[model samples]
Target: MSLPSVLLRLVASLAFATLASSLSHAQSGEPGCRPEMAGHRLPIQRVQLAKDEVRLTFVGHATFLIETPGGVKIATDYNDYVRPPVTPDIATMNKAHSTHNSRRPDPAIKQVLPGWDPAGKGAAHHDVTLGDVRVRNVPTNIRSYEGGTDYDGNSIFVFEIGDLCIAHLGHLHHPLEPGHLRALGRVDIVLFPVDGSYTLDQEGMLEVLKSLQARVMIPMHFFGGGTLNRFLARTQELWPVERREQPTITLSKAALPTKPTMIVLPGH
Candidate 1:
């Protein structure tokens, strides 16, 4: 081939590669969960937190209080039954049951993200960025009381803060689909329900866990020790189960366990 023709071909190839890279970024946004917020973020209320650290408190049942490094407070399954001590900056709720959601949220909360659409048109789509954390959801269906399926009735809320992706499986009724896994991206920590009957059977939930393969797994909505113990017994061989006396734990990207571990936080 002539030297001029070779040079033209190489330039065209480079241009195509650049265009593909730009299109990928435009389609997928920044990374884990959703796009990162630009400009000045909200002031950090708690200055003690490091830039790479996040504090999580399991607040009974399926409720969890996730505090970001920027001091943004987020309460998962924010319902009236199991309330957090302080008002949360962002509240995420599901429609599986009354205990998993509240129609009237605290007026002080800056954002209230519901799992499902109230109008019943379609699944609820939320991509919210507050402070230093970005929150998004993957909608899932729930089993209705009438033995029917409530499509897009539940949501798995994923919190992207610092360098970690923490996912809360709110009232999950079945194992996740391949598309759901793709939407979740990468999850470092997972908060899940262990009650076999309420959410999913032992085998089904185990399958979900296997698919997620997160570094840290926390159990919630297990009712009592009996239910929780049953789950721990079944999975102790697969992963290490550690029962902690405290309900809150501080975690960082650099401090995560090398292997998948289940840490049971003390709560209702």
Candidate 2:
């Protein structure tokens, strides 16, 4: 039977979407998935679309600078602790702690996405596409001042660019639930908070890692070597920890590691 042109187009689009989804999962080495470019390491160089690479620099604490191949610069968990050398095109903030957000950000930033809603909304729903990078958030609860839990107080911002899904867990106060994992999608790289006291404890953080199961995990928000070592010791059994001397790293889908790895970058 011959189908109408409109219906044919719709079918084609749906098929393409399904294929893309399958390919994304395959790249992560999940159950029964086979991907073409799963274990290749990209060249270490500046940001360039020719390489399909994005540069991530750890500024300090929960903040990271993400530079895309399409010339879009994004700052994750931007605050006053340490600012990016240059003003970023987009800044994602979470107000769980003072270091996770800044009341007054540089007005020059093109887009400022705050995790919490000042108007008392339950969650901050964001799905903004800028240049070649798409920014979105999965809201999570945070520890409140009065020893209770605050709803939708933090966001786990995810950036999708050039076939890579990068997520930054900002002030993650508790272990993620099933819904949180569903919203996070399949993350290729994750910038995680490793401060046992400030954020999640070692046991709690391990639980979060089990749920996300990202290939590359970048440790952030750690205060000292002692604290960082404690987290490293915990991951020795299941996760391999690598210390990166340089603060910046360029990543591409083809350069992902086969096993889940914990990467440490020096910063405040």
Candidate 3:
């Protein structure tokens, strides 16, 4: 006896899905079970965004509260001191310092992705998709307190939503290499640290920023106005700077600036 044609087609479709899932895991170096995408579909934002818009709110420090069109909320460098007002669906943390990561994350967060591996393994890799948002990370090294190299200690998380790719450089310590650039393809917006001391030096960071060639560059992690002003002064000749009064900014792919511009949102 032969199976029905419809049953055979269903089996083939299931097989293709499994193969694609496995391939995705292999490429991202996150083997085993994929991230669960349940319970994060609730629309929690006060104002609904358009299908092609993404809202970014400066929550202070390196944390930026990102809201997608599908109502998925993401918090970058999620820490206790500086956190989003509302609980985020996905939280990404870096372990470079206490302020970059949180020991106790909110239980309401469905996904908590650490930049480094907690089990003392290799780099931490994540490729998760939830509600029209796809989040991934590119591992990078950080400076150890002992003046040594902490390999794969930080991660540069990239959020893909609404035809835009927003990258958050988490506690970065050095300039990106060729391999890193290849991994991060077609970056539209970049959120980078501008302290110039803890992260990469000012010159090196500026070089990295140029190499990325993103349309919009947003500065983060600077402690004070003096620090941010210095960075802005250096780049004034290279790119135009826009200091926004509000802490929140909504962006869409079609509405991006024509040239590379630096956007400074008001916040700590």
Candidate 4:
């Protein structure tokens, strides 16, 4: 009712808004710190990739070589087994086991982001940009060999390129917490591990898949045929399955499936 009272109220409101905005920025960190990075959206006719497209190559044992349109190459779970011959622009590794994490990565690689610290004190945090691709990680706890617990032992690496988000669940041993999901945001393609004993069990892995709601789901890290076959049988009735003879699959924003689909790459 009073002029002075209205002015004072407006000032207070603006101050509160500023504080809220500051907090949000702090939580997300700088531009590269947050994985839920947003950019301009381009609409194209039909479900075809006009220009922005990414190629995902299964390099065995949870490792995937993600090649971006801008010539940025990223390798996930860069252990000794079946790494790409050429040096990658970025490499993301986990500490769940010896096979999932690398002890000695090539020094020539531009960026090597390990999921956990070797000292085993705190979680791993990474947000980096290589060329047109942006890479970030969300850490999760792992079960120790001595029947104990190791905090931040694994990382779900998220790659954002060409307006598409791809996630590699690097030896994820447990279900994702709310914070992890919030950090991951929306995943277009997910490289998931289906080994029941090693990673999340088949049923639990399915639950994680459902939670993520990714368009392209590729199974990896299975030990043998038995485990992989069982996983396929379990999900066939629900999600669609596509077995590709080749190891790599290229996808784009427009090519993402309407419903969740399981894509099995030949190299395991």
Show model 4 residue runs off by greater than 4 Å: 1-50
lDDT per residue (tens digit) for residues 115-229 in model 2: 9887886899999999999999999988888989889988999999978999998988899998999889999998888888767898899888888889999988888888888
Expressed as tens digits, the lDDT of each residue in 90-117 for candidate 1 is 9999764789998688899999999999
- The TM-score-based order of candidates, best leading, equals 3, 1, 2, 4
Clashes of 3: 0
Off by over 4 Å in 2: 1-51
RMSD of 2: 19.0
How much lDDT does candidate 3 score? 0.90
Best by TM-score: 3
Q: Candidate 4, residues 1-268: lDDT per residue as tens digits?
A: 8999999999999999999997787666644643321211112122332458988878777888888877777888887655764567898887646677667777888999999876666888899988888899998888888878777888889999978999998888899878889999999999989989977788999889999999999999988888899999999888999999988788989878888899899876
lDDT-based ranking, best first?
Answer: 3, 1, 2, 4
Q: Which of candidates 1 and 2 reaches a greater TM-score?
A: 1
Q: Alpha carbon lDDT of residue 21, candidate 3?
A: 97
Cα deviation of 83, candidate 1, in Å: 0.9
Would you list the clashing residue pairs of candidate 4?
none
Q: In model 4, state the lDDT of residue 193.
A: 91
lDDT of 3 by residue, 77-145 (tens): 988677777789999997646798988889989999999998878999999998899999999999889
Query: What are the C-alpha RMSDs, in order, of all predicted structures?
Result: 19.8, 19.0, 16.1, 19.9
Candidate 4 whole-model C-alpha lDDT, 0 to 1: 0.82
